[model samples]
Target: MLVLSRRAGESVVIGEDVTITVLEVRGDVIRIGIDAPRSVAVHRAELLEQLETVNREAASPSEDAVQSLSAALRSRPGNHAG
Candidate 1:
């Protein structure tokens, strides 16, 4: 990881399009602004992790859950089979 010291209003450029600028700094919290084209996708790390977890859960369900859902569907009022 490349670490550089930058004060407020200073910017760090990535490649040719992305730019990260420091907007404000308090005692500990620092606010930053990111400038990139609409084509670029930017997301917070934690939110991305949460979305991945949800996707994994949806992709792979437990056997018990599959059985329960099947049973529920079979027991529905209009689901009788001849």
Candidate 2:
């Protein structure tokens, strides 16, 4: 892990396009601003973790769930199930 101490208004650059700047410091909480191109994605760690968990769950469906979904879709109007 890279560790650096920066005051408000100070910034660190990554490669040629990304910049992480410290915006404010209030006691123990620090606010930061990031500058990156639209192609880049930035997400809070917890949110990213949650998304990963949801993706994993969706990827692996239980047999009961698959059966329930299949039944529901097959029961729809104008739909046929084999």
Candidate 3:
């Protein structure tokens, strides 16, 4: 990671559009402001991770769901073996 030190009121620019500005520094906590275009997506790291986990769980079929689907397919009208 590229690390740089900036005091409050100092800003860092990324690409040609995004700007990250330090707003306040209180003890160990620091507050920052980001300026970007509407098309750019900015998300907190932890929140993004949570969203990814939820999406993965939703996309994957459970064992019970797979079994139920298999059973339904086996019992369908034209699916029987002669």
Scored by TM-score, the top model is 1
Model 1 weakest lDDT span, ten residues long: 73-82
Tens digits of per-residue lDDT for model 1 on 11-82? Answer: 999999999999999989999999999999999999999999999999999999999999888899988774
Shift of residue 25 alpha carbon in model 3, Å:
1.1
Candidate 3 local lDDT, residue 31:
100
Q: Which sections of candidate 1 miss by over 4 Å?
A: 73-82
Q: Candidate 2 clash total? A: 0
Distance (Å) between predicted and true CA of 82, model 3?
13
- How should the candidates be ordered by TM-score, best one leading? 1, 2, 3
Q: Please, what are the lDDT tens digits per residue for candidate 3 over residues 1-82?
A: 9999999999999999999999999999999999999999999999999999999998998999999998888889988664
Q: Clashes in model 1: which pairs?
A: none
Instruction: State the displacement of the C-alpha of residue 43, model 2, in Å, after optimal TM-score superposition.
Output: 1.7
* Residue pairs clashing, model 2: none
Q: Candidate 3's C-alpha lDDT?
A: 0.96
TM-score, candidate number 3: 0.72
lDDT of 2 at 19: 100
- The Cα error of candidate 3 at residue 26, in Å, is 1.5
- Provide the lowest-lDDT 10-residue window in model 3: 73-82
